[model samples]
Target chain A: MRDIYAPRIHGIDTSEIRKVFDLAAKIQNPLNLSIGQPDFPVPAAVKEAMIQALTDNKTGYTPTAGLVQLREAISTYLKPKIGFETEPDNVIVSTGVASILFLLFQTLVAKDDAVLLLDPYFLIYPALVKYHEAQQYTIPESFDEADVNSLNDRLKKDGKKLKLIIFASPSNPTGKILSETQLRLLSNLADEHDAVIASDEIYEAFDYEKRHVSMAKLSPHRTLTLNGFSKSHAMTGLRVGYLAAPPAYAGIVQKMVTLQQYTMVCSPHAMQWGAITALKTGIDAELSVMRKRRDLVYGILSKVTKLPYPDGAFYVYPDVPIDSADFVTRAIERRLLLVPGYIFSANRNSIRISYATREDILEEGAGIFCDMVRELG
Target chain B: MRDIYAPRIHGIDTSEIRKVFDLAAKIQNPLNLSIGQPDFPVPAAVKEAMIQALTDNKTGYTPTAGLVQLREAISTYLKPKIGFETEPDNVIVSTGVASILFLLFQTLVAKDDAVLLLDPYFLIYPALVKYHEAQQYTIPESFDEADVNSLNDRLKKDGKKLKLIIFASPSNPTGKILSETQLRLLSNLADEHDAVIASDEIYEAFDYEKRHVSMAKLSPHRTLTLNGFSKSHAMTGLRVGYLAAPPAYAGIVQKMVTLQQYTMVCSPHAMQWGAITALKTGIDAELSVMRKRRDLVYGILSKVTKLPYPDGAFYVYPDVPIDSADFVTRAIERRLLLVPGYIFSANRNSIRISYATREDILEEGAGIFCDMVRELG
Candidate 1:
């Protein structure tokens, strides 16, 4: 029975997030902050558009790359924004940035190819690279200006095998936005090394201090941009995302679309219709609300533990005095849900707290977190 | 830049269906029968259910395996019907049977492992196998009892390497359903060889003459049954499907779910709500409509080319005297669209006609097909 699976199955578990979900599920009124999705309801207008689509019977399969007009809509939005020499043919619609990233990695990485991830990377990047039988190498350090120079030195030594670099801005655990200079450094390295940059800009709408600069905007020829409506509009269940590549890599884009066509066909047709509205209606109010939450978390958690002030997304990664798994377990015992930093980074001295919930929950969760840290001291 | 892609991508192209889609896009009032989706709208109740789900704020991602009650709904429907010793834990909801198949193959098939497909298989099967770097060995002939014996004898010599077999009943191009005896023979061969079975039952409700028998029922210990709401419920655009495996292979199921969690997360949440209604509502009316169209097609085109009287699904594969590509081209010149047989099989002298459209359109398409054949004669 064990032999019934590919060897990869034995190595792959259900994801460490499952551990947190299982723990959170068992607790009564747990002050949970583990998951990275916005807890807000989808925008009313977007929901209305989807309902209208269903009413109009837009349930037939769209072209595999997605509806041409939706692709056009995406390119129109991104061209002036992301600085791509872009068009509809350069974008492929997908169920999420998840599926787009999966296809992108599989399309680019061969066996033994080295894919570079920024340290404290998204939890799933290594999993994807491992499944493709590729090697995963994180950058020498985080992408501060000094760290970027260190990364360039490492690349100078072993750059030829570098196939892809996937780093999210306003990232998952740290919520740190890459500065424009940082983006330029990575873009230059990717261009010099012939590596592709997968700028996972899923959190583009939540930037607090500066406008988000797409890695593709910094280096269009060597970057593939991944973004979606999931976070910006609280449409995670809708499963709408797109990968925008440059025309110079149309053949690779075609291959990714072909893989998606034979796998998922297209994203759910009705959702694609809803996404048209989602992109049009901005999320300024929601962003402001989240900005306050981030501020509140930074304000309170800073009293308890050392942490960098997060500039984007909705999470704060703070250093914990105890082992992260032990810290999470103790938090669970107190009816609090938190993710260990190791889930995002190789470092294990910190924990990630998402501030995507209501102000009251965020306040309570941060209060409990502070009390726990004081107790640890 | 094309050289930047993995070599596996070089061998892949857009699906053969795309050629039909592209050609049909240009034709005005074309009698198109090249692709295999129903022209019917999604059932009203199901559409309303999805709309209501969106209204109810079911736009957040479900658990990776899908909504628990949805998986329970699928298992409850199949338990008495397919005879699987299964539970909700045994299922993973996917965007469609296409994604399910892709994951199943990647989960089960190792590189160079021999996979057995019935000849004239669905076009996507080989593409999926090749993507996994697997070797595809076809059953000696087709899935008649005679062919089963031929396959058994063939496997007797190479049984150790026979990893999996994928066959669709009430199949896409030919619309042929496997007899019980044929299924039993396949079950015996798979058991003797330790090979897994992927039963693609996407067209289960389309069977008109005999009750559909699932391969999982005959080989529950060694089968993965794939089914979905896309076909019978006419929700192709909604993109909902599931794979049900035996408890003995829980690890495989878990692996599949993990792969999905990291890739697509889950199917669209609103569609899952629609799928619950889709499963409960019967497809008797749609079946009868398609049955009548099948009858209309056989009456007209049986005179023009050699074809089995298709008993299920919406398509009939008819042998043509001239080369299929050439025949399809000539038909296209007259604004008629058909898929050449070479797209499905090594055989190149036939074409596939789908009767999934309105009866009037089916009649016109069949009439045009017959007239073209008569002209050839």
Candidate 2:
């Protein structure tokens, strides 16, 4: 019975972040700073569009790629923003950015194939590479020159086996945006190794300091741009996202669609209509409110400990004076929820705090978190 | 450049059923019978429930398994119907039944593992097996005692290599329900070989001739029962489905939930509420209507060719006088759409007609189909 599972799933456990979510659910109105999605409701126009599509009986399967009109809307909305021509043929609507990553990995990464990761990474990255029985090489910390050199040496060693270089911009667990120099270096490394760059830009809308840059804008031929509306439009439950492959790699897009035809069939159809409307609705007010929350959290936490400056997304990772697991446990006892940094990295001295909640709640949680760190230090 | 793809995805093509769908979209108001879902709009109660859930701001992610109340509702409803207890712990909600199949195959089928298939099977089965690089053996037409003997010999030869024995009862193309004796025999075979049974019963609600018997009721320890609301409530686009394993096999359910956490995150959040309503609302009227269409199709097609008796689902696979590819093309030229049998089986002399559409269109299409066969014969 123990042998019932394949080798791919043998040691893969439920994500530790989801465990924190479960723990938060058990507590009675704790100041929760562990959620990964925005704390806002979906826009009215988007909800209405979904309802109307249901009323109009758009309740059957869409084309395996997605609704034609929705694909067109995504393409039209993406071209100018990403600074590249996003043809509708290369845009595939999926259940979420997560599914796109799964499909992309399933299509490209073979057993023992190498996927380079920039640490600290999103937890799902290594999980996917592991599930495909692929080899993962990690460059500890930032994508600076030192890390870039390490990546170059690793790719040179692995040669043709390095199939992908995957990273998130405005990354989860850390919210650090990759600089243009880093992106360019990665593109060059990918070109030399014939590795595709999978750039996850789901947090593109949350860049507070500077405009977000897409890897496709820099390396159009070899990059797969992954973005979705979950964080931006507050539609996590609606589960709609898209991936744009350059026309030069339309073959990959076609293969993914065929895989999607057997797996997801298509993303939720009525919700896709809602996503089309979401593209037209602006979240500037919400963005401004979140920016203030980020500022407030940063103002409080940086006073107490060494913290990475987060210019985008909704999270801030701060070094804890004590073990992060011990600190997280103590915070839970005090009715505060946070994810330890070890879940996202090999390092175990930090915790991730999300500022995506109500400003008052996030402010109160930040004060409690700082007090805990001070008491322990 | 072609070497960029993994060997697993090298030879897979988009489903031919999707090709027919694309062809139907290009034609004008053709009497379309190739579509796989119910033509009726989703039930009003389900639609209204989804609307209410959205309004109530249940728009964030649910637990990876599903919403608690929805899982409980599914458990409560399935117990009496399946003649066994369905615990929430052993159920996992997924994007669709197709997704569940994908997760199940990915979790259990190692490289070169054997999966026994009953033909004419759903097109997605082999595609999933192929993508996993597994071995698939087919039992050509039905599950008669002769086929059972062959299965026994195959299982004996394969020994521990057979990881799964999968089939769709109230099947997709043929709509043939397995007899209880057949289910008992397969369960014994699975028990003897330590293979799990994957019983796809998505069409259970559409059974017209007799009450559908679940394989889980007889072999609770070995069977995984998959059912969904897509056909029952006409909510195909809502993308919610569940797979219930025995409490003895809760480990499999847990592994699938972990897989879902990374791949789908969860099924569309608000739609799970709609699915809760779908369980309580009866669709007897829709079932009866589909039964009449089944009768009408069997009547028309039996006169012209050898047709498999379809007692469930929305399709009938009838042998054609000409090659099925040629027959499907000829039908399309006359503004009718049908799926050639080779898509589902090695046999290439049949076409699948879906009676899920309007009665008038089905009637018209049946007449055109008979005339074409007569002229060709």
Candidate 3:
């Protein structure tokens, strides 16, 4: 029989990082820094909440928009923390923020519509946009800051066909945050162009330079802010995330969520309860630990001859003296694994290293990476 | 501002059945039979597996296809039970069978393609097909045995445009199981028309009269078998279900799953561990309990003044002597709750009564139901 696989799906290869992690798993390596998950245990309180929910028989399906209490909690949390005054009606709890983005892309973009990506972006974003039969337009990030004028120029050039603009701040790989002025400029341009902005704030809690500013707070009219517990609370496996939107777009997203209702009902009910606890009790200690780890990795990486200082997330994007793919291959040969930056975009000389590891592992991995660079030099 | 809600979402008007349930909830009714969830704790071994996984911090994302061990267990379990020589590659663990159905629709059905559904069917099936922009061609069940020749004639007439056909056996609402001959005939028709057959056997263990046969076993070339622990082991809240298909189609489904990976990375890692335990240990005792409940309710429901005895799932579909909506409302007035058949399809004279409650509650609910039927008569 002819291959039944959809053409769009063929383009999404498994994550390069996951491939490395698989290798690490096979070798039974202790203290590997290959994958993006946090090293901390899920909070005792969060786990306790899940156990309690399970015992309470809270396993039946919740409303597709999610539990009213959780959405309300998210609304409350976002307003004070991110300056976005969202109502419960404007929030939909999803299986994860990943699902929210998938739904948003499905609802907003049709075949042939273009979604602009801030290049060196999340690996999944391009694959997701492509799955909708939508085109992806990547605008390389200006290392100094997000350049709003250039972005506006691109939006103006695209005319009416640009459906969405996706960016993460404290971005994955790059770890760059769009300043408030830059966000205002992009938001204003999006408004003028009549395009939606999907701001992925999954890494918002891990930012170091300044408090994260949500695009929704700056432009509530056109932004859908995506956040979740996976990153902030070390609950990646629990798979709970949500989308907060303006009331105008809420119905569209809700319709998409209703479709999701048939697929994965509400996020696992116990996980929803766990997420409620995570949001209600802040992740201060968790953030402090990640920050400390981030600082340690950044300090070591910055001392390397040609690497740039790290910014945010658990990653460092170092400019390798050789092709990134080759650099990564060489590093792995010496028992170190780092994601090549070319997988995120087209750059060939940069590698992305995740600091989501124990300090000792980070120290060992960084030493190996430094030795590799010196050998290559 | 202009309503920014996407054009696709149509808000659900509160149905008469929902109104009845709302009133029942307010009154705190004891013999409630409204929703479809089974009233049983998840098996002890399953719970133990989950607790052990949690304690061990087996809380990271599993492979997108689900944990290898769980898929292998499902493969081993289904091989003999369903008469299919399945391999691990043939199975993909999903958040629930609901998700498997959703992914199948998205992957196979394109805009305006017709998918054949059996009515009165599961309520979510049509909605999910609609979400995919596919046309739902529901052939109403005969209440007598399904006429394979008539179904074949319809498929012959539609031919190439019919992309898929879905049926549950023993079916939901009606609970009628297709005989082996009927399944073979349907499989022949699906093969002739090149249409995919999705066999939802989530309630396979609830079959009381005879062994259940999977359509995939009859036509492995053109069928996908869906099953899960929710109904069988009362793990509804745990939300793990799976689909097993021929290698060619399983690949397509897996790709579609990859696209929605952001929604759920895998079934909860811990849930997969629990499900493996559920499958390994077996659900024989649980099946016996459900069969006993089915026998009790079937007997009680058959004695009602004017109701039909239907065959599968935990539900007994009986014709209400009064307007089904009115009968349900009246039942709620006396503190009973049953799903009116209109929600499943356009069956206005029947209601679906679940036999998933405890025996004492089932006895009381059935007595009240029969009393109401006789009073209305």
Candidate 4:
């Protein structure tokens, strides 16, 4: 009976982050800092566009790639922002950025093909590779001098088998943005190795320090830019995202589209209309609010705890006084929901607190989290 | 450069059906008929529910499996319909039936494993198996008693390796429904051999002859029922569907959910609420109109050529006077958009005409199609 399933699906488990979400649902009015999406409701204009699409009966399948107009909109919007030109054909709407990543991996990864991932990375990255029976190699922490040199060594060793490198800007769990120098070094390494980079910039619009730089802007020929409106527009459930690759990868990208044509089809049609509005209106208001919440959390947490300097997205990862899983369990017992960093990383040492909630709740949660760490110490 | 792609994706191209769609879009308002969706708009109640969900600020992620109430709604509705009760946990909501089928095959089909498919089958099924690097053996034409005998021998030869059988009820292209006796034989055969049946019942509500019979109803343990709102509620763009399996395969199904969690997240949340309403309201009115279109197509095509008597769905597959591809091309020149059967079938002789359009358009297109066949003869 156990053998009735596909070989790869054995030993599978639910994401630990999702488990926290489930446990959080049972608690009443806890200061929840464990959310993975923005706390704001979708913008009125975007919601209105979706509503209008429903009224107009735009509830049928769009072209397999996406609505051409939305693809065109994404192309125009991303070009100036990323400092690169793109045709509409380069953009493909997906159910969400999650899906684009999945399809991209499925399209490009073969068994034993290795993809380089930065450790303390997004949890799903390695999982996607594993599902495809691909080998995953991790670079410790950041693309600092040592890590970059290590990458060059690993690429030389793996040669053509090291097919991809994936990382996120304003990365999940830890909201660390990759510096331009680091991205440029990565681009050079990829060129030397003849590999590709999957730059996940879903959090691109949430940047607070320098303006977000797309890796694709620096190395369009070797980058597949994966992005979405879920975070910026507070439209997580709307499932609107796009993947853009340089035309050099069009043949492979088209194969990805063909796989999706039979599987996921296009992204949600009405929500794609909402995304058209999202790109048009921009996410300034939401970003400003997220910035404030981040400031509030940082102001409190940095006082008592060792943490990474917050730059973008909505989370702040801090080293815990206790084991990561234990810290998360204790927080849950105290009616606080914070995710353990080990859920996202290779080690069980830190916890992630999302500041995406309103200022007051995030402030309160931050204070409690700090107090809890102090008490444990 | 082709070497940059994954081994499986190299030979992939756009679906032949999609090729027809691309060519059709270039033509002016000819008697268009190459649709695969209901011509009617989404039900007003369903559309309004989606509107209200959006307005109510339900624009954040639901659980990866789906909204609880929606899953519960599907479970309750399907219990009576499928003759076996399932818990909400057994129903996994997906972006569309397309995504579900993709994940299902990706999860179950091991490389080199052989799965049985009905020829003239839905185009996506074989493509999915191929993409997974699995073997696909097609059963000749339809599933009759002889076909069942052939299936048993194939299963015996392949033994445990031949693990899956996939077919659609109220099938696409031909709109043929499997009789209960045929279904029972398949179910018994599956039980005997420890194989599984993937019952694609996306067109369940559109069945016009006998009440739609679910393959899951007879063999819940070995049947994975795939159904969705896109076909029945005219909500193709809404991207809501479910894969229901028995508790025995919860482990396998959980893996499918994990893949989607890392990839698709969940189906569009607001559209899922519409699906809840879709189940509650049913699709009686839409089914009645489609029945008229089915009858209209049968009346015109039956006179000119040999064709399957379509009992449900919105298509009538008719044998043509020339090669399927040649006939499809010829029809396009005459300003009609008919899909050739080779796009859905193993051979290249018949073409499929969709009657999911207005009566006048169907009549005009059918006449043109018949005249073209006569001219070719």
Give all candidates' CA lDDT scores: 0.84, 0.87, 0.75, 0.83
Task: Compose the digit string of candidate 2's lDDT tens values, residues B127-201.
Answer: 878877888888864667788677678756876356898998898899888888888888887877788999999
TM-score of 2: 0.97
Candidate 4 regions off by >4 Å?
A157-161, B157-161
Judged by whole-model lDDT over C-alpha atoms, candidate 4 comes out at 0.83
Highest lDDT against the true fold, candidate: 2
Cα shift from native, residue B151, model 4 (Å): 2.9
Better of 2 and 4 by lDDT: 2
Cα RMSDs, all models: 1.8, 1.8, 3.3, 1.9
Q: Worst ten-residue run, lDDT, model 4 chain B?
A: B154-163
Candidate 2 Cα errors over 4 Å, as ranges? A157-161, B157-161
lDDT of 4 by residue, A37-113 (tens): 88788989999999998999998999888998998888888787567767788778888988888778768888888
Candidate 3, residues B1-377: lDDT per residue as tens digits? 43333344442223344455557777664578776777777877877787778767777778888888988888888887667667777787887888777777667767667787878888777776776667677666652235555665665686634678898887777777777877877677677667788899988877777657888778887888899988877777677999888765766666655654645677888778989998976667766787888888888878764443445678888888777878887787787888888877766888888877788998999999988888877
Quick one: ranking by lDDT, best first? 2, 1, 4, 3
- Against the native complex, each candidate's DockQ, computed on alpha carbons, is 0.73, 0.75, 0.44, 0.75
Give the CA lDDT, 0 to 100, for residue A314 in model 2. Answer: 95
Q: Which stretches of candidate 1 lie over 4 Å from their true place?
A: A152-159, B140-146, B156-160
